[model samples]
Target: MILEAVVLQVKKGMEAEYEKAFRGASKIISSMNGYISHELQRCMEVEGKYLLLVQWETLEDHTVGFRQSTEYQEWKKRLHHFYDPFPTVEHFEKVYTLES
Candidate 1:
């Protein structure tokens, strides 16, 4: 599995709007090919910050397939404006799991 992690720094006063938009946007991503599951986490230490952790079957499924798809365009439209500065997204592979 490939893990895609996105840390969003939302503009002040945009948290509610961002959450609503993200709820809508999540559906688009969840329907895509190779999409496994995802979680959206709000930061308690810092307001207006969120962490998105998504799982895909492979890196190509997210980097190439999803980003190149029309759904991603919709995703961008729904959620991009809420960011103060664009968030940096990174991908990872499961090296070790303690819970398993």
Candidate 2:
């Protein structure tokens, strides 16, 4: 499995609108191939910062499958404008876990 992470900095005063848009756009990603789960975490210290985490079966599932699909166009249309400087998304693999 792989994890996709992005630090989103929403444009000033658009936080509420961004969240609303994200909720509506979530379906687009959740339905993609190899999608496991995802979460959008708001930063406590920062007024317009958020962390988006998505789990996929493989990196290509996101980089190729999702990003290249037409659904991505919809996703971008729904959420991209809310961002200030566009977020840089990164991928990761679990190095260790302490789950019980």
Q: How many pairs collide in each candidate, listed in order?
A: 0, 0
Q: Write the per-residue lDDT of candidate 1 for residues 1-100, one digit (tens) a residue.
A: 9999999999999999889888988899999999999999999999999999999999999999999999999999899999978999999999988985
Each prediction's RMSD to truth: 0.9, 0.6
**C-alpha TM-score for every candidate:** 0.96, 0.98
Name the candidate that leads on TM-score.
2
Candidate with best lDDT: 2
Q: Give per-residue CA lDDT, model 2, range 9-91, as digits (tens).
A: 99999999999999999999999999999999999999999999999999999999999999999999999999889999999
User: lDDT of candidate 1?
Assistant: 0.94
Give the distance in Å from residue 18's predicted Cα in candidate 1 to where it truly belongs. Answer: 0.8
Q: What TM-score, to 2 decimals, does candidate 2 have?
A: 0.98
